[model samples]
Target: MTAKLPAPITLTGRHVRLEPLGRAHVPDLFAAGGGDEEVWRWIPTPVPRTVEEMAAVVDARLADTACEPFAVVDRASGRAIGVTCYFDASAEDELLEIGGTWYARAVWRTAVNTEAKLLLLTHAFEDLGMGRVVWKTDHLNERSQNAIQRLGASYEGTFRRSRRRPDGSWRDSVYFSMLREEWPVAKARLTERLHAGAAVPA
Candidate 1:
């Protein structure tokens, strides 16, 4: 099968469902994270001070051909609690980056993030036949780095002066990746953790 950008689809797991992001998710998305400094701290964009600003963020992602954005809905609550994306898609290279991820404070230490990664990684490597899935975060964001490492991604390296942060300071990005040949082992570990009730550490 040829690797390609995933078409808009719903990915369901025991803990959450990732749906194609849309305007309908805006209210819940805003309520979930808008203006929460801590939630947006490590993110590239500044904290959106209003729902409209958050909506613009979502809209920009939607307009970008390179990104497939999803609204992460908690199955138990039936609410959009977060956002994620499969971005920087390269069909020929058989790879994509799983970035632009953030969830509400309420779901921060829950199974939501773990299961969401499971669903996304499964779809990328299993369904789309991608050879690699990449993840990156600010070098100082230890919490995010730990979460990515917990998912079994190997630390590729750090990219110095990668990009300017919202506050106008330069950010050094820490990169990690998992390969297709390594999927079975990584998948098994992630699945076991999810089944064992492992959550993203606070």
Candidate 2:
């Protein structure tokens, strides 16, 4: 709570636009991946079965002062495809964690995610002046861990039984981080991938 996170802002890129999340995004979001178990597999929340449920999820995030949530909009179709956020920040330490991210099944490994992260990381380091950006994912989610590493984050270790999953099972969280000093190289690599369309993000 010590960190002063930025107010919600829109970040536009060639493949996606990250706009402040709202109830208005529920429908497109629901259409994008609602009721699809795969899309919500790694998300802590249970699969939202209805637009109303999706609205509730969006509302919950809006009510959390610590979170700055964004609805990821695919530029080509002008539809919201998913959500991501910035939370768990500490201003005294000049650090923050970016978690609560999930994209529609269709856009899973496309340039959409690559461009979106490029925009977010640029803002986090250059605009917000954060010294470090962190990420945490389920220990069993190797695909996600790989994705984080692809973004140049260094694995920091794991927090055993950090939280319970939606299914009520204990979950161990794996942590990763990227310091400001490492952003330049990571940024270059991310930019190049975006320029290349990053079809599968090898």
Candidate 3:
């Protein structure tokens, strides 16, 4: 039997909007994702270099039931600023992996990134009733590792030489996960941080 998929989720946070990614989002997404070579350095696929390429990628993603990607829109500017996804969703195991995340440098280190993650995690754990949410990053990407740790996800060790990157180099991947038992505390902490950041004067 085919596995059941989670209903398309549209999540809006204090600083960002998460809409199901579609072809229409390509033009804006290409603009958001391009211009930053560093952001795509650790990513597996070549960064979308043009609007047509971005549209093709979004189209393929839309056709894949296993992956539910979202266009990350900055609420302040009302512009799409990045992309994220929940891939490798296993309904039978009540588990899902949140990966393929990339954001523009303009929003890096801001509350918007955290809010986007909080929205995705909340939907995965509380809304879809998932037992665990998994996160992984290239071991060489310390920034990503630190961000995941800040989310209170337990470090599950690294997979040595796990996969090859687009640059023809081996990438050891560090894995992290937050269990259902840990969700309440994690959720509360993230909620407090997001609310506090929102109240700050720009």
Candidate 4:
């Protein structure tokens, strides 16, 4: 018999739902991320300028074996607000990287983002038995870098001249990681922070 593949995983958190990418999500995802030039400022690929382009990008990602993207839905509103992926996965080494994440300005710096990330990291280290979970962003993306630090991941240094951006400029990649041993304290702190933030008045 063929070895069984892991069942399609759907991770639900308090604030967000992570569903495996599918054609059904294309329209919402396009609306959520398409035509947002600011979202793509630090990334290589241009934001999808049209629905068709968004669909094509999602299709390509679904077809790739090395990476799997999920549509991040805000449970409170039942709307897809962004995308995130487990890429450069190494099952043999029990490693995975979370990247390609982008959310709308409305949700940025909100409880939803923190809860969503808490869900992803918990699943990676606790549920999937990953030894280490990695995160990376453009070196110039101080916003993202700060978010990573806020999640309690250790900064692992930068890869200088890692890749060329769409604008023909070289980009440095900053890396961060949370090891299995660090998950307990990290998760507790993240949980406390999210819960505490939720109680604050606007």
Candidate 5:
């Protein structure tokens, strides 16, 4: 497989669709996540107080070339409910990290996140032909750590005081990675979960 990064493209799944982030999503984005302290706790930026602040955050991510941000739209409601991104890409090594993800409180334990990861990992390993996909989270964030581990990423170690959080405090970053060989099982597990979701009645 050649070393190449995923281009900007929409990834559609049963539960959600990943579209390029844009200003048009501002209203739904804000409605889904804005002003929620718990939702923004692990995020690097402060909780957005208004729609404009959230739009500013979107604009900043759009301006950054190192990342490709996407609006996670729930297919059921046809509204933007979250955001995720493919960042820190290294085309030479066929490596990249999927970070910068957050969702509305309502969809926290639902099929939304599971299917989103399925779509992303599938694109990374199968479509982009990436050798590795990395994930990182604050050491103190146990929920995030468990989520990454559940996705079949091996816990790699922590970088002490890796970066400063929005609160001006040091954050230890715990890293994890899933190699190409491990994707099949992970993909299977995610697919099963999504199928289970589809089987349930509304």
Candidate 6:
């Protein structure tokens, strides 16, 4: 199985538009979610303390060939309130992991995450023709786990001590995935949930 790596593209939804992550978004992103430890808790990198640090982080993400990042812009505010990405892609395997996601507290209990994910998944399977889309979160992040499950991904199991966190703690990676065959049902459920203004725990 083979697939092309996702190219930079904008995925628009009712609540948000996922623009290709760029330097221009750092200011808005910083204003939106920067300096929030809670938002960066499960993230592997150091919590950015300033806009400059945020720019450095964004640059690092953009420099990585394996990462295709997006700035999650609020449709109403037109500000980048968060970031998400297709990470560690394997074109030869028709697989990629969706990781490195973070959002502002303002959008936490809203439909923003649900709609943003719908856009990404639609493009992953329908446009990129990917066979699988994966998500892995720290075992300690129950909210993230719940969010992934709510997206109709099946829990694959845990990988113990998969990596060390920025704080040097061993991270047990909890894995979930949605296969192409199962996408129709998941997509239907997600679309319905989106209409209901569902609050995702991601």
What's the TM-score of each model vs. the native? Answer: 0.95, 0.96, 0.91, 0.91, 0.94, 0.95
The per-model lDDT (C-alpha) reads: 0.90, 0.88, 0.82, 0.81, 0.88, 0.89
Query: 1 or 3: which has the higher lDDT?
Result: 1
Maximum-lDDT candidate: 1
Alpha carbon RMSD to native, model 6: 1.6
Q: lDDT of model 1 at residue 181?
A: 91
C-alpha displacement of 115 in model 1, angstroms?
0.4
lDDT of 5 by residue, 47-115 (tens): 998999999999988987888899999999999999999997886788898999999998888888888
Name the runs in model 5 displaced over 4 angstroms: 1-6, 198-202
Identify the runs in model 1 with alpha carbons over 4 angstroms from their true place: 1-6
lDDT of model 6, residue 95: 83
Model 1 clash pairs?
A: none
Give a tens-digit lDDT track for model 4, residues 47-135. 78999988887888787777778888989888888888888766678888888788776677678778878888898888878899999
Superior by lDDT: candidate 5 or candidate 6: 6
Which structure among the candidates has the greatest TM-score? Answer: 2
Candidate 3, residues 1-202, lDDT tens digits: the string is 2243557778997678999887777777788777467878888877778777778777877887778889998888888888899987876788888888888876787887778888888888888888999999999898888888888799999999999998799999999999999989988888887877742111
Q: Considering TM-score, which of the candidate structures 2 and 3 is the better prediction for this target?
A: 2
What would the TM-score be for candidate 4 when compared with the true structure?
Answer: 0.91
Question: Residue 33, candidate 1: how far off, in angstroms?
Answer: 0.6
Best-first order by lDDT? 1, 6, 5, 2, 3, 4
What are the per-model C-alpha RMSD values against the true structure? 2.0, 1.4, 2.9, 3.5, 3.2, 1.6
* Selected candidate, larger TM-score, 1 vs 2: 2
Where in model 3 is the C-alpha error above 4 Å? 1-4, 198-202
Query: Which stretches of candidate 4 lie above 4 Å from their native place?
Result: 1-5, 198-202
